[model samples]
Target: MSTAVDTGGASDLTLRKEAVTASADNAPTAPEPAVGATRKEPPPEKPSDTRRRSWVVASFWIIVLFLGLPIWWHTTSIYRANLPLDRMLEWSDGKACRPVFPLRISLDPGSLQDQEAENLLRLTQHALDDLNDFPAHHLRLQLAQKEAKQGSDVALTIRLTPGESVHTATSSLHPHLPILDVSYPPNSIPTPMSSSSGLATYIAAQLRSNFAEEQNIINYLLESSTAHQEQRSKSVSQDVAQTLSKRVTRSLKYARTYHLTFSLFTNGPSPSSWDIESAIDQYMRPVLDMLAPIHNFTLDTQVQLYAAPGVQSQVLSKEDLSAFINAAEWPLSPSIGGAPTVNFVVYIGNQTIGTEAAETSQSWLIPQWGSVYLLAPPSSVHVASDTLKQPILTFTSHLLSLLGTPQSGSLPLRLSTLTRVRSADLLLRASSSLGSLARLSLALKSISIPSSVADGVAKSMHHLELACASLGNPESLEHAQIAEAEAERAFFEKSMVGQLYFPDEHKIAVYLPLLGPVGVPLVMGLLNELKAWRNRRRQKAKAA
Candidate 1:
């Protein structure tokens, strides 16, 4: 019975197992991966495709290299005109020009015979040559024509007259002309065979003395200059050098034209009108006319009432004098032209200058700027020419100082000396500017040198050459002015500074964005191509 029960149970369990097997067979089964069918290898790229890709990459690079790069370069490239750097440096170094001032002094035989005048001139020239310390500045004596013409190129004319009562030779300069009147006794007349003569010696001494201040000043300039330092004369004493330095510092820069603005500034509402026109016509016109050859002057006058000075001191110290010009309060605006403006102020105030502080009690000169006069309260509201006489005279004197005229010698002599001095100054200034430009070009490679700049430099050098050739001549001043102007224009070129303002960092900032994205893909593509080619080469070698 137990076996029957066990068989039934087993039969039931077998049926259950069959049922489980049938259910399992009927249920969804997972798909098996085919072992033999592996992933198929991709077909090798076609030669055409490879060629097409290469052409695409090459075209992109070609566009960038040939078209884009050229366009960028063309757009960004600086136009650098060639400059005569060596010649510029030569001029700056004084190697191109050694300025020699051959001052031509004409000797006029007034009462003496032609032969006697010639003998005296020869002996004087000899004496001058022996006494002259500076080789660059030389005085050349020449026989004047029987009739000396007006506006002759001669620096000065020495007229000789025999004085029956005179024991020795005596010289007197013409007050208004560049003529020296020499009176000598008949016995003092130099003979043709005589190596030395008292008259010649006296004349030589006079000439030397007359030109001594000019010589000293020029020597100081050369010594102060970087270019002519080696050629500077050692004869200039320290005191004289200091004095020259002071004068130079005080003097105005060279100009073709100067605007003279005469201003009357009063502390109170009085003296509004002045006879400045008549005063200038009387006291200043002659000097202006004299300077007309070297420089042109434009005169303008104005009156400002209730004007206060920067300093209110009654007795101004040296320091107070410097600060006396009330620049902000005064209507002393420069004249609207290319020429520099020189101011002459007559302040009708109760201010007095200290005796020790000022050279004069009436006025004080403002170096390179102008002059100021302190006038006591005038008797009338309208100042007359006679009342303005002393002040105008002071202004005239100050004008000479501002114009860089030498202190010694007559007005005409001083004016002539001014011409030569100005020529030298302009020459040196132009040369220095050229050197600065050359150095700038070499130092700043990115700077654009325009054709105009090159042209200016060329013009400057040409004028410099001409000026150097005719150093002591009146024409030299004109040439030097042109040279200085050209050099200044070249150095301070607007385009040069304009380009300089656009720096390299700014360029990179402008170009980087355009190049970065384009460059990355090009580089990656090139690298991929190289890797493919290398792999192909290795595979081919293995196959071989």
Candidate 2:
């Protein structure tokens, strides 16, 4: 602790210290270090700078999340409703349900004793079982519960009346019902305990003979389907098969309504009208009305004068038949609302065909669709209904075959078989359609399927289920029609497979414009920032 003392020196030294000016203003405002201080560490980075850099990265993320991604998703996304895709695939593959056909045959005890009727039913069933090779097409024989039920149960019933002969079989299929009259001697009736009898075999053989064509058709369709793998057999050869194939390929697929056009064509103005409406009403209406159970027919008649045949030569060749229709000039348009049209033309021509007049020259079937009848140029008087008797009769018979009616049966039996045939055809068609849809969906990955397609599939499946439940009945045909229509709708849904416009190159073109440029810069910026941060971290660690 030494005290300071001020001593006056020379006068000049004291005078120079009159006022001291402030030292030169600041060179940089820095904290002063103590004497002999070491170099000052650089100031730690400002927290604000770090915050600004983080905000830049965060802003980019916000733009991507709120704007860019939303726009991309909105533009590229497809509107696909939830479909039961697995179920559809399963159905197409025949994994969902196996279609089995069981026919219902009723046993009518109309006039026989209860014991005798029961015995006859059992014996007939046994014989039928022995004859049937396909278990899927089993015929179930149920006893009619009541007299009214008896009329409805069995497809056909035997009167079982006593007769002079040992056995006799007569069938009546007319304007009304399906009835088969079997008169056997009283002594030939089956005993209550017997499992087999001679009468049973006869009845079974007759029934088999009646439904043979229908059975063969069903077998053919089944063999064609993928539903059965090992059961297919070529029962008929190509020549015979060609004939049956023509029958199927030419015949119109079954429909609820058929349009029947009866036209009378004349080269000269001799026969203008043939009293067609009246003739059709008298001859054709009854059959059409009877067929109302399976199909509805709409009839329209026309008469055209100065109509020339497409062929002019006297003899018509096989090639001449196609041109004979004059399809380019004929007004035979298809009926609206999905029903197929059938054309029956009675051309009043003076010419004859094939040098022979008797060998189907007057009329010929147009494959499955219709028939063309060449009528003799009638007397030059106003055409009357009586002149059309032959043509109309021919037309009526042709209509049956065009509708795919079986060859060997009465009209009633044929019509019943038609219902069964139509149901089977539609069912198989629907199934095939489903398979095609599945294949189409799988093959074209980029194609879009609309919700309407799923809805149609659901409706089709529902109708198919209903149809399958009621097979071999008229109701089955109705259900099958619904199924077929819905399946077609599903298969051909307009929006389902949008024309595959966006190819791979198109997608690349679309994305490259926006994403390519924008993504590169953002990725570079992110990488640079990451590297800078990593370098800073390593430097800090080294210093520590």
Candidate 3:
């Protein structure tokens, strides 16, 4: 009975186990967790940590914006001084100044009564006014006091004397002095009641003819300048304009002083020394003394032995003459002291000019530069003053030409005209220079302008004003020179040119290393902070 009971229990246990297995098979199983569905999430950042990170990014940017950028700007920024741009443009356009020359002509009536002289002067002035077409030039007649000496204000003196014939007048210019001698009949003088006089008309005509060349030259200058082209009256004919243009171009630029370098160049080594000093003293000193009122000259001489010219032919053609000066081999370095040098070369060679040019078959003027004279090979090793007379005379002529002395006037009158011309030239040159500086300042935004440039501009403008006011006087030349010098200084300032080479690429190259590493970390930190802030905002909105 025990064995049977144990068997029954075992069977029951087996049945129970099978039933558990069947129940396990029939019951639904929990689905396996999807990939990453049960992964452990990192802890949320603390509010303090997030705020600190944001503060760090803001601090970096604050330092860059407030401290670093300011420092960089202060260190690298160009200091540009303010300039008077409008005034400069106005001066260049010839709107600021219009030059007028009022020539004071003294009327010396040697034999006429005071009333007759006054009447005659009035009639003469009227005639001159009627005849003159150029408004820029004016001829004013003044009565000369017998007791008073000739004043510096007087440009020319007209001396009247009674001629043998009646109702006749003749005029002649004094060679040495600035005097116009007028020989007129006793009856030619105007009475106090008369409206006109034949002598007065004759005098007016003579004066007009005397100054016609100067008028034409001044007209040419006005027409040639870009600034004054519109202001010109176009009174000069085409042929006259061409001639005046040549003269203008051929003349040297005006300066306070001129250096005269007389050189003796020899093909052979025989003529070693010359009596240049003595020659110049004899033939050139008088002209220099006369020109002292207008220009001061400093003289020097040199002798170059065995110097070969650029041209080697025995006969030099007109073209060959142009290249005869051996610039590479010649010792024609300009003198120091900032004056233009006029070189007069006396070449001792057997070569002769083959062509019959009008200047000379033996010598030629180089136009604005100098002159050259070909001397037949000298007999002596040492040149005497007598041997150099011709060359010295030729040099004097060339010096006058180089100085732009008018061809039609007497020496004193020409010098006077030259003063006015030089003053006008300098005035225009300064105006043009100021214009260039203004345009340069506009075109080059990166260029650094210094306070010195502004100062120079101020000084130049001041002098320009003074020059314009004194255009007809000698003081005009002085004022114009100062203006020109200051303008040049302002235009050529060294500091302004340096900034042109420091380009944007150069600035990048200079600042890249300092800015790159520091900039990257700050930028990345700011971006991460911005992303975190955006995520937090989204989470808060979802929870709401």
| lDDT string, candidate 3, 335-451, tens digits | 659889999999999887876653337888998899999998778899999999998999898999998888886887777888888888889889989999999999888889999
Which lDDT value does model 1 have at 175?
91
User: lDDT per residue, candidate 2, 1-544, as tens digits?
Assistant: 9997656665656566543322334235788779988897999777688668867976897899899899979987777555566766666665655555566666555667898888988998889988977544667666666636444324555445566875554433333656565666667778987768887777777767766777777767666676642333345456656666777887777778888878878788786667888778777778888788888888777787878889987667667787888776667657756568888998888655663444436677887668998878767646677877788888888888788887876777778878887888888788777778877777777677788887888888888888878876678789888988888988887776455555678878877998888889888877877887887889889999
Q: How does model 3 fare in lDDT?
A: 0.88
Q: Superposing all C-alpha atoms, what RMSD in Å does each candidate have to the true structure?
A: 4.1, 10.7, 5.8
Tens-digit lDDT track for model 1 on 1-544? 3553456777888899999999999999899988888888999999899878878888888998999999989998889999999999999998999878999998888877878878888899999998888867889998887754844578898988877665867789999999999888888887788999988888989999999888887777787777897776675887887888898899998888999999999988788799999999998898888899999998898999999998887888777887788788898957658889999999999887887645548798988889989888888899999988999999999999988899988999999999998999899989999999999999889999999999999999999999999999899999999999999999999989787677789979988998899889999998888787788789899999
Query: Per-model C-alpha lDDT, please?
Result: 0.88, 0.74, 0.88
Shift of residue 130 alpha carbon in model 1, Å: 1.4
Residue 126 error for model 2, in Å?
Answer: 1.2
Q: How many clashes in each structure?
A: 0, 2, 0
Residue pairs in clash, model 3: none
| lDDT of candidate 2 at residue 335, scale 0 to 100 | 74
After superposition, which runs of candidate 2 have C-alpha atoms over 4 Å from their true positions? 1-54, 107-111, 142-146, 149-153, 167-176, 193-195, 229-241, 355-360, 442-445, 500-502
Q: List the residue pairs that clash in candidate 1.
A: none
Instruction: State the displacement of the C-alpha of residue 408, model 3, in Å, after optimal TM-score superposition.
Output: 1.4
